[model samples]
Structures are given as structure tokens and as C-alpha cells.
Target: MPKDTMTAEQRLQTVIRLGVPDRVPVDPMIYYFAAYYANITVHELWSDMKKYEFAINKCFNELGPWDIYYPINPISPEAYMFILPMKMKLAGLDLPPDEINQVIEEEIMSADEYLTFARSKTPTTFLKYINFLSTLACRVQREQQGEGIFAKTRIIRKMLKQIPVWREEFKRWQARDVAVQHGICMEAPFDTLSMSRGLVSFSYDLMDNPGPLAEVSLALSKGYVKVGDWLTKKTGVRRVLVFCHRTSNDFVSPKQFEQHAFPSLKAIVNGFVERGVTPFLHCDGNWNKNLEYLYELPKGKVVLQFDGRTDIFRAKEIIGGHCCIFGDVPASMLAFGGKEEVTEYCKKLIEKAGKGGGFILAAGCEVAPNARPENVKAMLDSVKKFGYYS
Candidate 1:
């Protein structure tokens, strides 16, 4: 932790208090983006925090003008234990694959394979799980025959445990005064199950097998408590950001979210608030269907990180004062459009959401991998130029 580096605690508190920081928060999930820009693989970058830090700072210096930074965590390999994998490379993206451990393969299998997996404990599980999934997602344009090859069960459970380690690393960034936010999620139980089972199956399970799913929800809540406590204790930070990439109104019907997502999500949000930790939920899609449900989350307990699909003006009307709001710039507009377009979008987002002090200017999602470096610079500059109270 650098004495001069801004702490996550300070950034989060200032944001919640509706106070402008030295600059707007640039809390992006830049794992692959930063690594690729630095000519390093995500696996290598994550394994060596020093490289991860260097890559982030470099990106910030060359490309940023961001206030908050997210240190990348390697995807857990347990998720890919029994499956083939893929990756999502933009036009010119290139990175090598990291190997997964044999034990991870066993652990992710059915209960029948537990004995085989327990024989050996290795870091390879996390590596393999992440490598496999990244490989799988990357192959989306290639074919559909091997789509769900990475959807193993037990392995995902173990991967869930890795949340704490991820948080611990984010804490490291906070200590360095970079004020890192956890990627996607760490505090929401429903989002956790959705990530493990894929949004489709989990949605159906909540309707068809509510009993078992509820049991799983309870169990996951316990895990969230453990992870949240660990984050607070180790990081000594009061604010934690949880990105909701896939769990959005665009992904499922409102009824499905109410039945499958809200209960567990609320449980974890309440848990965080009870402990006095502020929560931020990133919804990277159209949330018009359930913005109210989002507000139903424990009041000030959660902040809304809306994506491009969400209407920032509507979001402000609904929960601006009740909770803080972050993000709304379209990644597409920023990546494929021009400076004026980026500037216009930023101006709109700020005009609509920044009338009050609770709004933060950021991308609706991550600044895309293939986004023009100049475009990213333009986007951040827009915030500085436009995201002011005056």
C-alpha cells in the first residue's frame, strides 16, 4: 500500500457521502484488457500481483484518467474442471492458455468423484477453471456444439470459496491507495448461483425446484457472510462493489428475478449493511423491468451501477437519493464511435444523473478490450469536463 495512493475506504466513503473525489472513480473490471495491453496473459498477470499492479498503473497512466482502479483476479479454474473451454478475443487479441490442475478436474465432478479430487490439493484448480471458461466464451462465434462443456457442478462450489481470495487481492490494491472494486460479484448469493449454473437453468430451478434451490440459497448466504466478513476484516474497508454483469432484467423475466434472484440477493445485501459495509450492485443491462426491485434492496445498503441499457434518468428518478448510482455510458458507443459521441453520451449521463451528488461517471460496463485507446481517454476526459455540479 502506497502512503500516497488513495485507499478504497476513503474513495467509497466519499462517494457515498456524495462528495466528489479528486477525480471520478474508474473502477473497471480490466483483468483481460489491462493484461493484453501490457503484453501479458491474464493467468500470469493474476498469479503475479506485481505484474497486475504494474499493468493497471500503466493502463491508468497511458489510458486513464480514472480515480478508482480494479486489480484483476485470474478466473478460477474449478469452473472448467470437467469441460472443454474457449475465449473471447476481439479483432487482434492474443493470449496463451494456462493449465488447470488434475485435482480441480476431480473436485468439480459429481459427488462420486470427490474422493479422487481430495487426494491432491493444488492452485491449478483455480487456474484451470478460469482458463477453461475463458476459452469457452471466446469460442462463441466459432460453434455451438461445445457451448456448455464448462458447466460442471461441484467445481463451481469450490470456485465460490475463491471469492475471499479475490477480495483479499482487491484489498491489496486498496492498501496501495488505488481503491479497487471486486469484479462482478462477491456479496450477492443469487448472482453467485446464477454464475455457477448459468442464468437459464438457475431461473428455471427457482421456479421448478424452489425447495432445493432455496436450500442452496441459504447455504450460499452463509458463504457470502464468510466472504464478506473476510473482506471487511482483512481489508478493513467499509464499501464493497459487486458487479452484476449477467443477472439483469434483459437476461430474464421480472417474475423470474423476483422468484430466483431477489430473495438471496436481499439476504446478502442486508448482511453487508448490518455489518455497516456499503454495497454497490453493477447491473449492466436494461433494468427498467425491475428498477423498483433494485430499490427494494436494503435502502442505502446498495448502490446502483447501471449499464447502457438502463435509462439513467429513470434510475435517478427511482433511487437517486435512496441510493448512489454509478455508470451508464455505452461500451459500443465508446468503442466504435467518436469523441463527440463519447462526449455527448457522457454529457447526457451526467446531465440526467449528476444533478444530485450521488452519481458516478463510468462505463455502463467495462471499457471494451478493442476500444480505441483514444476513445477511452475521451470517455474519461468527458467525465472530468462534464461531470461537475455546476
Candidate 2:
């Protein structure tokens, strides 16, 4: 396809084919990038779509890259950063740390709370409180452990009956033409489980309650499949990027990952493809450990978005032909590396990965909240200067 002839969606398809364009596509996972460009706080970005739209335009018009993520919800609700599970003593509890912990600990909800929350005909205020606690827990673990702990935590698996209600809400979201695409996920199931059951308890349950765990995961994917189908039907946007933070290669060994995680994920991806929807995996950290399994998916039918921890060179050689390979320009580097380094890195990626098609340029994950405007300029500039095919 000629560069000038491409539509926004078509241009993305071309890049996925590994075909060079008039320029390399710029599709930074914009969340913080939007906030910084708009000169607002992260909180505002989450609550105000108009402000977010302005920020997205600022980056897009100034940077001039490929298709934008164009979030369906205010800041992606699916991201783990927004859904940790920890409890803190609310103000005026007036107990020592140990006693306060015990009091709240007694109130801790069981794994069934996950399904109850998901199955609610209407969202409850208590559900919101649980969601907040989960987010706080995830944040605290990351801060204390220096890596995400949610993957190893215990999650309560709900019965299949609880899922239909959530699916109905998704249908409603679809009927509205809410966004051309709904996220690969409307919510994080595993993250939800972790909040109801703490991480340590959850990890043990994987061994102790493998049957229940497996059942829950299957149920979760079933929910996602309905959502994915509805999104595709409504907007004709079948391409989706599903994200996972705690399940990265660095966090889970192959044996453990394949056993606990892969089954449901594979089902979700297959479900999407069977319905003519594309499944793009948004996995950060080192995926080197699971390359063989990742390759098991249909070639050129899926997309992989990586964080800096992924080996882009090796990933290009491995899955570049079968799936669209996106990202590797680390956000932190863009924040500190300045224009010259950014240009060189992008050029090198183009030369190596942009061969034989199926590559897209993006940040390792998101353009961080504080990434410099000039660094973003450098990325777009480099792609334009070097991304054209002869």
C-alpha cells in the first residue's frame, strides 16, 4: 500500500506488515504523555477526557506519528497501576499499626468477592472501595519489592454465573459507540483476585486450589471474549492490545506461567481470532523466557508491545514475522537521552526490525508522565528521517 493511500487503520496494518512508510509510525502508549503535554496532573487525566483529548492532539500534531491509542476510558482502567490490592488504616482508626492491621484484616473480603463484584447488576459503592484497596496494595508491593507481586498472589475465582452481568454492561458500552475500540480488556481479573485475597495467600492457592484457579481464569476469558466480540461488532475495531504487568517473564518461570496463566490467555486470543479480531499482547519485562509459547499463536495475527526489559533484537528475530512487534524506545531513555540518542536508537531499530514487515514503533510501554516534549520530537523526527522504504 502506498503511504499516501493509507487510512489511519491501514497505515497501522502496513507497519504491522513490516512495510516501511513515508515515516515510522509514532504510537506512544500515551497516558502520562497526555498529562505532561496538557500540563495537568495524573488525577485530572483520569477524570477529564476533554483535557486528555487536548493532550493527545498536542502530542499527535507536534509529533506526527501513526495511529493514537485514543483511550476508551479515562486513562486505561485495565492497567495494573490503577488496580492494586492493599489495605491501609483509614483515618481515625486510632490503633497501633499492628492492632489497626488486625481490625482491617478481619474485614478482608473473601475470593468470592471477585465474582460478586463482577456479577453486580449495578456497581456498588463497596465494589469501588475494594477496587481502591486493590490499587493501593499493588502500588505498595511494587514500591517495597521493586517488582510487581500480584502475579504470585492469590485470587478468588468466581463461578461462571457471575460473569453474564458484566458482559451485559459491555454490550451497553458497545451499543453506545463509546469508542471505536474497547480495550483488550474491560478490567483485570487476576488483579481483582489479588485484592480479595492477599498476594502470599493467593500464590499458595495456585498450588492448593489449582482447580478453582483454572476455573476462574477460564471464566474471566469468557467475559473478555464477549466484550471483544461486542467491541468488534460495534466499531469494527477488531484489533486489540491486551496488557499484563505481573505476569512478565521476569516474574514467572515458564513452567509456572504456562500452567497458571497461558491456558486462559490462549483461550482469549484464540477466541478473538476465531471471531476475526486481532489479539495484541501487551507484556512488559523479559519475554525471552516464553518465546516458544508466544510463537505458538498464529503468525501475523497478533501484536506484541514490549517494555524496555524485553530484548527487542531477539524478539524481532523470533516473532517479528508472525506478529507485529512494537516498542523498545524506553520512556526513561527518552526522558533523559535527548534528541541525538533517541534518533540513533530509532534508526537502529528500523534497520534491524523493519525488515520483511510486521513492526511498529512505540515506547516500551507508555510515554511516562514526565517524558520531555523534545524527546518525543526526537522519536518522530528519526522515524520520518529514516523510516521510508525505497
Candidate 3:
């Protein structure tokens, strides 16, 4: 067998820089499926950080080599609360043991509160002002709770404990020769505000009151560098997940996006690059129109990952040269299709999107909790069969 010329770290780095590597990097977003494959229950993962960590390591080692690992651990629900500030009902509580988490969006932050959150442009002040998520939960507690406005809340205490735990998880992925994905994650300020205000209320705000919304989002954009810095300090990894589910063209009109979303998006993306952090965009909807705007971001330092909703092939035609591309292997096929079907889809992606240097093969979204094991393997296998470079 021919030997790989670059390490996993080097391989991913090359692709992000828009340079050809030994092969197209493989980043299977193996999430809940890892637990099911490893015979661990979701409840166990929520209760024990050690078991959650063990399940992840076992999945990679036993399933064999996987290049970039997201390791979206099941234990820490608060990791997300800091950004979106919405209640997430995770599995093993009111939900079934193996079920995925759900976000319960309500009007947690009133239209009246927007001014205060937008003021400091600092999360420390904003989070204190917002006072944690509306439907707050802790896996350790397994019940709903509330926190009042304060200098510091219980969530900070919980997150501090998680830092040591998350650091070890990153180390384990490294031992397996897999480069861990973002050590920290971010959300577009518009998505954060839209969800926090509830969809109905947010829509009304968009139509009825556009001024404050724009002001707060742009102000929120200024603080992302500090947020990334703080998160990088805690996790000791430089890659950041800048998730964009609601801000895509699918969710809002182009005019609305241009006014409300784009400025903040640009600020945060550039903010990360200015601080020397790689921003991994987990764009979850049809971003066909938005792809045209991404070229303005720092070339070769940003990665755009789609969840099968966007036309990834056209995305390759569009920003494939300007930024590294990741994902679009449909979750449905991985769960219901045969290995041949999965392989053929991957072959197409490898041949087309993978034609150039800036692409990483990954599931269209999170690997479905029930994806066929053989199909998951096929996604990885296709890379070896068709992804080599001269």
C-alpha cells in the first residue's frame, strides 16, 4: 500500500489552505451513531462523562482511521446555552434514552432586552444581562431550572468543570491519530437573537422593528473575538464552529439577510481570522444564494459545511476556490440506503467537489442516530478508493 505523505493534522491544514493534500480529508460527523455502534445508551452518556469519552474513543479506534473528529460530546448541555441561550431538552430526561436533543424556543429575551445585550459587546456582560437560557437544563440535574440575573450563574461553574473533561477528550482523539474539530463553537448573532425571541416574535421584530435588531446583531459581532479567545483559552484548540442554521437564504429574504445578518456574519468570520482561529461554518439550510457572499471572508482559512440542504456541487463551482468545503453526504442515505448507494454518492462528491484541493468529505449533517454501520464505513471506504492525489 502507498503510504500517506501527511499527518491528519497536516492533511486538514493543507485542505483549509486550499492546497492539495495526500487525499481528500474525511470528517465523518459521527455523533449519536457512535454511541449506538459502541453499545452505549444515550442515558449513560448523559450521566457519565467518562463513558461518553470512552464511547467516542472506541468508535474511532474500532471503526478505524477517521481524520477530523467533531466529538460533539453528549454530556455538556450548557456548552450551547452560552451562545443560543435557548433551552435544549436532551435525551435521558423527559425524552427517551436514545433520542436526540431538542431545542424548546420561546420568547425568553424580550424586545425590551435587546438594548442591554447589544451594549457591552462582551459575552461576560451580555450573558450576565441575559442570565442564561430560557428553558435551562443540566444533564447532571436531569430537570428544568431557572437562573436569575447575576454577576455569575451556576452554568459557569458547570462549564469550568467541563473544561478539564473536554481537554482529555481532545487528547484521546489525538491519540487515535484523528484531528479534533472545533474546540469551541459559535452561532451567527441573528440566529441567536431570532431563536431567543421565538420565531413568531422574531418575525414581528423583523417587520415591525428593524433598527434595534440590526444594532444589537452588529454590536454582538464585535464580541466574537473575545468569545473565541476565551473558548480557545479553555479548550487549547484553535478551530471554532460558527454554526448558521437560521440566517441562511432558506430562512430569510436576501434583502433582510443583507441588512440584518450579513454584517454580523462578516464581522464574526473575519474576527476569528484576525485572531488566527479557523472558523468551521456548520451551515444547516439552503445557502445557495449566500455562497456568493462568502468569498469576502479570508480565503483558505474558513470551512463551509452544509447539511445536504444547499447545492454543494454548485457551492464547489462558487466558493470552492475561495474557501475549503466540507460535507453534504445526505443523512437519509446513510440510514436507509445500502453500502453501494452510499459509495456512489460519495464517489460523485469525491469526483466533483473533491476535484480540487479544498474539500473534506463528511455527512450532510450529523450522522443520523440510526445510520447503517456498513454505510458509515462505506463513506470512509470511498475516500481511500477514490480520494488520492498525485
Candidate 4:
């Protein structure tokens, strides 16, 4: 399998199918790093689509070749936010230009609201509540920061105009061998409830009133599957990224996770698998206690991506040949380590995790904003040096 024989997309797909490709596919989770490389503020990158395109294109052209490029920030839903009246700091309204917008976690819904939502059991109802909370969050920021309302309107206008332009750019990038992986983004049901209901309250509900929360989570899982199906049909991309934040051992005990989180998460994974789509689990936090549970999933239909907290070496030993695995390179190394150090670390990763043919080399999580450019290039270069299969 010579490197020249397959396109970057094909090379990646080969690994996804548990086959050795010409090289281990390099797909760093990049977002604000684009703003850093392009010498623009994160605000500017999200405020204008052209700047966003330029920043990402600069990364591909200057940084090094990438098998896949995430064209937009996962948290910032470009034009769709215009239709749904919600505001997030990631969209560049409340946060400073250089900083990534933080998720302001607050208990917006009451315990009774969970029962109400479950009864309604409609995606529109759930989203309306979320949007309401988001709108209130924006109002609070405006009052506290002394910001004006007109800025949001301007951002919305730019996003509407940029939609078509972004599509065209994606097509162009795909033709250039840098395929864009875009589809519906979802959070595990428990994580979604945590965001809307507040982690403190949700934890209590899991103990005091686990029945209602479990029912609501089941309903939400169905909604997520429907949204994923619609997005796949609309965009012709059969993939979904599911953010499983609280399911990790950092937040829940292994017993709690198995009881409260795993069922809904497995339901979501199974739903997507039944529809012929691949579910990429962005399992953040240290999930050491829960790694074994992943074996229950439909093998080859999931890509288990880890943050630095998860022991990816152990994960590879457990699920390497069963499913595609990506990541666990510490963000700290990329942000502060020298190029030589980064290259050495990458070699170690390839030797351990890249052994069985179903590994994609990536930064454990999103490349930090301050990660050295030379270190990133070293990551891409390491593939050529050590990622080949005979």
C-alpha cells in the first residue's frame, strides 16, 4: 500500500474499516488553532465566513497535509443558529476575540420540567427550551458586559450570506484530498441534560428521581437519532459526532455510568448504526473504568476518540481490532513541547496503537490555541516517517 496509490479520504476509510492503509490517517481536532495560525481572533474567524475559510485553508496549505479537515467549529453552528434563536459565546458574541467561548453551565430547567419534556417527547419542544435558556444567557451577558444587541444581528447576516460560500469551499477542499467531515452533532442524553439542567441538579435527580430522568433521556436519544438521520440524508454524510462528557469516570462512578449513562449512549450508537452511519464517540475525561463497556457496541460502526485523560494504550489493547480508535496525545505536549519531543511521542503512539491497522493518529482533543505550529507540523510529518504498513 504505497502512499501515492490512495487518496487521503480512501486512506482514512481503510483504517475505519480495520485495514492497514498507506499511513495512519492524521486528523487533528482543530478549531481555535486555525485562528491562532491565521493570526486572527477567534471572534473574527466565526464572525465572517471568508475569514473562517481562509484560516482553515491556511492550516491545510501551510501547516501540512491533513487527511480530513473540520471546516467549522463544532460548537458554533454557522447559519442554523439564525433559524433557532439561541446564542452561544462560541459564536463570538460575549467572549473576547482571542478566547474560546466557555459554556456557561446553569440550572435553567426545573426537575418538573423533565417530566413535562418527556410527556411532550418532541424535538421541537426540547430545542425550544434550550433556545430559551440560551437567549436568557445572552441577555445576562449583555447586561453584565454592557454589550449591545445589534452585534448578534450583524453576525447572523454574515452567517446567512456565508452558507453557500462555505458549501462551495467544502467541495473545493474535498477535491483537493482534504475531505470535510460534517454532519449532525449530538451530545449523549445525560450530557445534554447536564447542560440544560445543571450538573449539580442532574446528579441529584439521578438519585432522587432517576425514573423521570431515565425516561427523558430515552426520549432525547430518539430525538437525536431522528436529527442524525435527517442530517445524513440532507448532507449525504453518514457520520455523527456524539459528545459524551459526563459519562466518563471523571464525573460518574463506573456503576452509575453503567446504570444511567451507558443505556442511552448505547441506544444512540445503535440507532445510528442501524441507519448505516458511523458514530464517532468523542469520549472526553478519564474513562478507564468504562472502557470495557464499549465492546458491547456494534464493532466497526464506532470510532472511539479519547482525550488525554483516557488511557488510549489500554484502549487499543481492548478494542483496537474491534473498532477504529483515534487519539490520546496530550494537548500540553503540542502546546509546549519542542518539535523533536512531539515527533518522538507520535512515534511511540504509532508503535503501540497503530499496530493493528484501525488507528488514526490525532491530538487527544482539540489542538490548543497556543500549540506550537512546528509541533503540529511534526505530527503530520511523523505519519510519513513511521505510519506505513507493509
Q: Using lDDT, give the best candidate's number.
A: 3
Q: Compared with the true structure, what per-residue lDDT tens digits does model 1 show for residues 1-390?
A: 112233445555566666654434545445556766777655666456567668777777797646566533544433222122222232222333332111111111122222222232434533332333333233332333333434333344545665566566666665666665534335254554444454456556656665444444544554465455555565555556665555677776788777766676777778778877777776767888878877676654467887778887888898777777888667787668987888887787767777656667777667775666677777777655765443
Per-candidate TM-score against the hidden true structure: 0.70, 0.71, 0.92, 0.86
Off by over 4 Å in 3: 120-151
Instruction: Report, for every candidate in turn, its global Cα lDDT versus the true structure.
Output: 0.57, 0.59, 0.78, 0.73
Q: Local error of candidate 1 at 216, Å?
A: 3.0
Q: Number of the top candidate by TM-score?
A: 3
Q: Which tens-of-lDDT digit does each residue in 139-250 have in candidate 3? A: 2233445444331356666656767777887887777677888888767777888877888899899899988888887776755566666777688788889878788777
lDDT of 4 by residue, 108-177 (tens): 5678877676666334843533433233333333333222355444444444464455456667877888
Tell me the deviation in Å of residue 91 in model 4: 7.4
Sorting all predicted structures by TM-score, with the top scorer first, yields 3, 4, 2, 1
Count of backbone clashes, every candidate in sequence: 20, 17, 0, 0
CA RMSD of each candidate after superposition: 8.7, 9.7, 2.8, 4.5
Q: Model 2: per-residue lDDT, tens digit, 1-390?
A: 334444445656666555555545556666666666767655455445556557666776676544545343323222333333444332123333112122122224455544454444535433433333343444433234322335223221111222343344445434532222233343334534544466566666666665555456555676566665664555445666575655666655777678867777788888778888876677867888887788778766777888889888898887787777888789888887877888889989888877655777777787765778888777766656777665
After TM-score superposition, the amount by which residue 46's alpha carbon in candidate 1 deviates from its true location, in angstroms, is 3.5
Q: Could you tell me which 10 consecutive residues in candidate 4 have the lowest summed lDDT?
A: 139-148
How good is model 2 by TM-score?
Answer: 0.71
Instruction: Choose 1 or 3, whichever is better by TM-score.
Output: 3
